[model samples]
Target: MSRPDLFKGIVSVAGGIMLPIDQTLLPLKEKAILIYHGSNDDVIEISKSIQDYNKLKNIGTKNMELKIVKNANHFLSSQTFKDEYLYEWLEKNI
Candidate 1:
């Protein structure tokens, strides 16, 4: 997100925004953002994903989607499911 001009949309999987993001640029950035997190992720807690989502929303992300894969872990064990959703989301956003 450092260079919003380059990316049309952002897809974050098992990732979290640890540092504070400037709201000035974010509020004007209406690009689609997709966040996918595994519920049983041991590496990064799902709560972090949720918090990240909330942060994006609070900062004014218009077209954002958050998906939590059930029974999945940090590795995203269900590749099939992830691929399906990812394919769909990318097609729709990109």
Candidate 2:
């Protein structure tokens, strides 16, 4: 979000922001976002992405999507949505 001009859309998988959701003060409500997280991720808790997604929605973000993958891990060893959905999202957003 620091360099919004360079990014037209965002796709984050098992990723998170350093700051708290309520503390985010940037104008990110309109940025097209695709957030994905594995339910069984051991590296980063899924709550980070969940909370951030909810916070973004509550703050009036419109073009945002969240996918809480089941039976998956930090590296997404059990998920398969990337083959098609990811490309679809990228095609539509980017």
Candidate number with greatest TM-score: 1
- lDDT, residue 18, model 1: 70
How do the predictions measure up, each by TM-score?
Answer: 0.84, 0.82
Model 1, residue 70: distance off in Å is 0.4
- The lDDT per prediction is 0.79, 0.80
Query: In order, what is each prediction's RMSD in angstroms?
Result: 2.4, 2.5
In model 1, the worst 10-residue window by lDDT is 21-30
**lDDT at position 44, candidate 1:** 95
Model 2 Cα shift for residue 38 (angstroms)? 0.6
List model 1 lDDT by residue over 16-67, tens digit each: 8876868545643478888888888999999999998888888777898898
lDDT of 1 at 94: 83
